[model samples]
Target: MAHPLDYLYFSAVMYTSLGIGDIVPTGHMRFIAGVEALNGLLLIAWSASFLFAMMNRLWDWEPCVEPKDEE
Candidate 1:
């Protein structure tokens, strides 16, 4: 059995696609790790794009804090 903390660390490494190689997933776990890495990559990309859109809407290339008033 694997320790909880070790499992967590492994999951995080998979999620981040770091591939540190310290711990290797075997059998079915390998598929899960691959999926997790893809999911993480997509979510990160989505979040970044969403944030960029929000920033575009909120500021017109200015460092202002107030959100733009929508008509």
Candidate 2:
């Protein structure tokens, strides 16, 4: 039996389209790997969007506390 991390690594390779031939899925498992690949791709794209939005918001905003004037 394979560990869960094995599935994750396999999925990652498939998502990157870099199959190394050590872990091959057969039967229904093949469909599962396909789904994982699709999920990885979508998640990566969504992350990119989220990161950009966050950066834009941060860049436009200012610090909460302003510096006090010197005596």
Candidate maximizing lDDT: 1
Tens-place lDDT digits, model 2, residues 1-71: 99999988887798865677799999998887788778778888889999999999888776679976699
- TM-score of candidate 2 relative to the true fold: 0.63
Candidate 1 wrongly placed segments (more than 4 Å): 63-71
lDDT of candidate 2? 0.83
User: After best superposition, candidate 2 residue 22: deviation in angstroms?
Assistant: 2.8
> Which stretches of candidate 2 lie above 4 Å from their native place?
1-5, 15-17, 60-71
Best-performing candidate as measured by TM-score:
1
For model 1, how does the per-residue alpha-carbon lDDT over 1-71 read when each residue is reduced to its tens digit?
A: 88999989998988887879898989998998999999988988899999999998998685579888899
lDDT of each: 0.89, 0.83
